[model samples]
Target: MSNKQPESPDSAEIFERITYLSGKAQQMLLDFWTRQEAPAALTGDPFGMTSLWPAMTNAALSDPLRLAQMQFDYMQQAAGLWQGFLSGDVPEGAEGGAVRDKRFGSEAWASAPAFQFIKQAYLLTSRYIMESVGALEGLSPREQEKARFFTQQFVDALSPSNYALTNPDVLKATIDSGGENLLRGTEHLLDDLQRGRMKMTDESAFEVGVNVAATPGKVIFENRLFQLIQYAPATETAYEVPVLIFPPWINKFYILDLTPEKSFIRWCTQQGLTVYVVSWKNADETLADVELDHYVREGFLTAIDKAIENTAAPAVHVIGYCVAGTSLAAVLALMEERGDGAKVRSATFFTAQVDFEDAGDLKLFVEDSENASFYGELSEGRGYLDGRYMATTFNMLRANDLIWNYVVNNYLLGKDYFPFDLLFWNSDATNVPAKWHAAYLRDLYRDNLLAEPGGISIDGTAIDLSTVKTPTYIQAGKEDHIAPLRSVWKLTRHFAGPIRFTLAGSGHIAGVVNPPAVEKYQHWTLEGTLPETLAEFQDAATEHKGSWWPDWLNWITPLSGEQKPAPQPGEGKLDALEDAPGRYVKERIA
Candidate 1:
């Protein structure tokens, strides 16, 4: 009897605690439901509604469905609760035990007839008031139809799947992008939904124009970076050597011409090295006819001809980064095959891989079969690959960060804003030609032809990186996922040059955009001597601090002519052109 009395006090206390906890949890559920049901900015037009309408409407209609699900969940949870209680896992008088058991039931309460009637009544009354007011003003049938279309497009764009695939990637690459910890439990549908929302939010807000607003450096030669420059000595004589910068079209050329603090272009110019960078016109539907060779001939080669015509320099320094680096290698290879190296002096490759054998999971869509099928379907009406499609592929790389994070923050949390520069740059997309994308995927990504002596041809000229004897600075990032260190290291072996290999900190973007303020960046050397394989090099590598930019500047400066008062880009010796920072500002796309 005495033992039983103690049990009664414990039971009573448990009941009291459960009552308080259940009430608190019920209030939280109510708040969530109320917020979800609140009116959102929308159009009633059938076509123009947000894509979420379908799911939202269905959920609204079948209130009983949610109720039933909640009830079932509660039952399952209750069973578990009882098991825990019997096993003595739940402490007596604990509020958590009851709250856990009752969570689902609290949700089911919202489906009660009393609650349903009020909700429906409120919706009906609001619609009546809106329609009554709208009747006074009226709308034309055509106007109404247009409204419907707009609404539909908005909704379609907002669909979870559409948002997820907004910047799509192959599923394998997408999975790899998520990393190991997140790869687990990916099979769940809710996980996918979250991923979709997150990606769309991350990708949708990019605007490149903003970053250029703050850039320094005097604009030279018709206000274009990639213009032909006739090199001149300080004594008002044309130098024997001309130089050209072959910037990769993958990213904006301004990455090299960023703000003064981070600007590599400014650094080069200050060093008195004749510099010209290809400022690729942002492609759209109109520019779809352009192919890979157009860039080589009309771009790099054309600039070379102009430089020769202007300065009569026997050779020029052609440098490129990432994809452009490969393109430069290909051009040099083509030049070698035709014995046309007269206009070429030294070549420099920056974080570019001529070899694709170690390209990683980014190669899923690069298979020959995939390229053929994708190109056949995509490039039908248009002559070029749709830029939007290409953008979507890259977004899938980090679905959780890009897709799910956005969804949760923007839609779920009702908070949508980011001030990060990198995210903004990523959101600003550029189009690719259909032929170019297809060729890139098939020839470069899927096939490992470019590295071979006669693997792939450019206008019947085979591309062989080994044939390139340009004095090269092969800069690589130790942590680069896109171009792994091992693959990037292959350029040193392939290029027959007085190669000076450099390793930088961060991934792709940060490595390139490295500013001096980030002084504590760690880089590695070939253990004081450059090695052929990245693995061999890592074993013998020594770590150093500060921006690799300074080290790079020091290495290249000595190669440049002695610096006099900083030659105004368009002043005495060079072409008499416009002022600092030109045309890029007028071109705006958000």
Candidate 2:
């Protein structure tokens, strides 16, 4: 590695080159037995090179001209870089390199002749590969998406920032710290190895009840599946109908209650909305046999009933996030089938999908139904799918941001990062019952049955979304990888209600949790008839400023009924079991 330090640039160019790559294959192997007695959830086969290689083969054989052009273009760029290195008159923004690239932002990458050549060459090659993948012919849509995604994974992993030899910053850090940064990084790596998890945020910097999930509330009801917490009134008066939120069990509910400034739950309370959040219990061996029917009956119905009973309201306005949103759709259908649809006055879905026709990168985990038993095998013994596997999968979806940035920052540069509430919440995982997960993947994910009439039966009750005439509000993030906008938009066709579809600015979490005050991201809404495609929707939709919270309030307020004195936690049927952000949230994987 060069001893030279990275010099300052006029302005950092954020490159399109993403910094990230492969999960430590070693960690996956090492954690097998050390993973304790939990179930054997399917993580994934290491991005099938099989799919990618075929595309490469097809490109080379089918379009020799395209290949030649790509090589020729790369060569011209490489030659220009060589010329600039020799002349010592390198153009700072060669080929309009004005865009800021974090991976190659350092002036060392710009000013240094050798590094400049490396940077531009890598960029050219990356562009070549991406274009080739996009243009590759003779693959199904699923195969094409897989090829594109896996190619990106490999390209990102190979980013120059990941290595001390290539990344001037890392090289400088190693030299400045007399190689001690490397030692510290090694120690961090080992610590993570021991803990069997990646340490993203300063874990000690925040605690669940004290700081992160500190919204004032009390656990009023508990079952084998979840704890229902009713937050204290943040206003003197409240809407007659209470709000019950069922957050995705994929992670803890604290995401909705990150901090006082960021907490959606707090914001809801301040709006004179009575809020009740379901805190799902981390699954264990005892909960292995639990299935979708069990979740619908015990988790969703019970929580809805509790929220209504506590407020003595005729109905509750229900909101579901992610998977919970998907599950809640079924429950609504069940309610409609049983003549209990009146229990829910209106429904709000956050980044949820009933139609799996285009479920995004996540569907790769359950691509083939012939491998259906393989999913079952994953959860066969442990009875539950470990959340770490899910977390890892999610991280891979945006490997450059979630996984690789930390690798370069913590592992490469040995830098200590400030506490991030979102990362902290992300690292805090929850296990899912095996049977429930298998059924979920098989039915909704693998089979794409949720959107069909009578496709999914919970306890012999057919769940057809068309029967669900409850008024609905749906929010889908424009850039949500887990639940793509297109997939979420299909919900417009399934539910028989007045659908107020809104597209938010960011991805899943940031999009939904966006508060009105901070005013970070924007959202889009269509005033007229809903479009047939997401592209059409985006085109016709008017983009609004800041968060979508206010817009949602504007829509739901009319349906929420008249304001009355806000009821405190546990004012009715159920007694206060414990303080808010209850024990279920505190459970961690052993």
Candidate lDDT (C-alpha), each: 0.53, 0.83
- How do the residues 1-590 of candidate 1 rate in per-residue lDDT, one tens digit apiece? 35554333354564465456446545655654565532121113222234334533353345566546655655565555456446645323222222342211233223333322322232233333333322322334333333333333333334332232221221222233332211222222233233322233233343333343233333344322233332222233223354577666655566665445666665554445555555565555665666667677777677666555544445667778888888788888778777887567666667788888886545644544447655545555566544445555555454444555454344333333655545544544544566677777777887777877888777766677777666677788877767777788888878776777888877666776676666767776652446656777777777777667666666654454433443334453346453333454334233
Candidate 1 Cα deviation (angstroms), residue 492:
1.6
Scanning candidate 1 in windows of ten residues, the lowest lDDT window is 179-188
Superposed on all Cα atoms, model 1 deviates from the true structure by an RMSD in Å of 18.0
* Candidate 1 error regions (>4 Å): 1-243, 270-274, 307-315, 340-345, 527-529, 564-567, 570-590
Return the TM-score for candidate 1, rounded to 2 decimals. Answer: 0.60
Candidate 1: Cα lDDT at 398: 41
